[model samples]
Target: MSSSSKIRVIVVDDSALVRSLLAEIINRQPDMQCIGTANDPLVAREMIREMNPDVITLDVEMPRMDGIDFLGRLMRLRPMPVVMISTLTERGAEVTMRALELGAVDFVAKPRVGLASGLNELAAQIVDKIRVAAVAQVRRAPAASAGAIVHPHAGGAAAAAPVAASPLLGRLSTEKLVAIGASTGGTEAIREVLVHLPADAPAIVITQHMPPGFTTSFAARLNSLCQITVKEAVQGERILPGHAYIAPGGRQFALAKSGANYVAVVDDGPPVNRHKPSVEVLFKSVAAHVGRNAVGIMLTGMGADGAAAMREMKDAGSYNYVQDEASCIVFGMPREAIAHGAADEVLPLAQIAPALVARLRGAGDRVHHRI
Candidate 1:
């Protein structure tokens, strides 16, 4: 590719080896070119000003400033797509989530120190994320004063009647369950959607691309923060209302009907979409077991892993939704589903939860009134 066509990137890390390795991997890509490397946030700031790169790969732990602090400053000052490099630990995951909320695009788990064991895996993920980060839309945070808040019923008694029944006020039903699948940038994206759901939101089953030991902690953390219950799924466990279950990493989780209730069936299966806990696997199971009763959602992620399976559910008369391209860190999966005519609706992150509730309650007509 020509210089103008190449995706220019800046690599920021304290480690010289990591910097070199990342630069080498990025340069090897036909569409990517490394513009510069920075050892810390101070240098990174100057490099960003001088190089004006399209994307940045930043290390979470740095000498002068931590990645999270730098990310906040960067977002407020100069917004650009940033992919965080973090260690594979509970603390790292927590910090990574914070970075995403601060405006970083995505994250890649750094390899553990062991020759031949960790480096190979880390290299693959780093390269994949860099490619996706290049195409991601990086937007600056909106100014706090941009919008005016209209006080409900503050105008007069007549205004109070309509205000009392705002369109946004809708009840959530627990009789229906939602099954979601996502990968790459999913950790933060899923959190954004789940956090906004009401306490009585439909039961949720999530199959995110993750490894063993991570899902448990991720679920626990989400449970603590959200009103609805959240936990990692176990084999033969019945799905319940007002709770969310995350499929354990490294195992395929499928939904099976047991009389009147649904149960999660965990099994060691071959990797689909190059992922053991594949979204396709879970969505397919949901399509077969729940049919029209399930609401299937495919979120932001790389590859078309869940698109086909989401289509299967749509064909079975289930309500299906995909994240719109503008809000996605990577639009691959959702785009695929939308292109295949599988999604009943393509919604932004903010609209998904509310739309979900409306669909479950057979209130689509009322929901369409707002659109």
Candidate 2:
């Protein structure tokens, strides 16, 4: 491809080695090129104004300006796709979550082990995310006060308590299960859905594509904001109403029935569709075990990983929903599910949770897909 046709990129990091490694990896891709490198957000700001690259790989920590703070500024002043490069520490994961809410496209966890070897091992992932970010729909965020730290659902459960307390869902809550799958923009999308569900809502099981060491923080982050209890799925635990179980990163999570109650099955299995905690695995189990008592949700993501399996869910008598194009960061997964004749309703990101809750309460119309 010609240089002009390539996806222009900027690398922003404090570490010289990381910057060099990322530049090399990006330049090696035929469809992308590293146009510049910045050691901090200040330099990056100048490069961005001059070059206006298609995407930027940003480090989560840096001098002169904190990465999250910079990202909030950039999104408000000049919105564009950004993929964060972060250390896989508990703190890093928390910051990464904040970055995503600030409108970053995605993130790559810098492995805790060998620096050079670890980055080399993630070459495919690094490039793949850049490709996704290139065409992703980006929006400017509302500007925040200087020195103010913005967090998703800043009010926590204390602020979320009265928002979704449904007294109408009684026996229906215990009888049904909600199966959800997402990737790419899933972090914010999943949060949008879970926060709208009441504490008495049906059991929700989710699979969001992520590497190990991230989901624990992800689940905890959600738990603080949503009315329903949220946690990483535990093996053989009875699935309870009003709780959401997130598939552990790097592991498979599926639904099963033990005697009179539903339980979670988590284990190390071969990667399905190149993802361990694949949506396909979780949706399929919901099809086999929950059957007509299940509701399937396919959110914003970048592949067809769960499309076919979600069709199995529809065939098995589950009502399903997929996020519509306008709200998706990458429409690949939802488009595929629509092509496969799955989704019963195609709703926007903000509408999905309310719609799902209505369906469970037997109050919504199903106006809905082929992959």
Candidate 1 matches the true fold with a TM-score of 0.84
Q: What would the per-residue lDDT of candidate 2 be over residues 17-73, giving only the tens digit for each residue? A: 999999999999999999999999999999999999999999999999999989989
Please give the CA lDDT of all the candidate structures.
0.76, 0.88
Error of 1 at 232 (Å): 1.8
Best by lDDT: 2
Specify the poorest-scoring 10-residue window by lDDT in model 1: 152-161
Error of 1 at 301 (Å): 1.9
The C-alpha TM-scores of every prediction are 0.84, 0.93
Winning candidate number (TM-score): 2
Q: After best superposition, candidate 1 residue 168: deviation in angstroms? A: 15
For model 1, residues 147-198, the per-residue Cα lDDT tens digits are 2221111111111111111232243243467889887667756776676566
Off-target runs (Cα >4 Å) in candidate 1 are 115-117, 142-175, 363-371
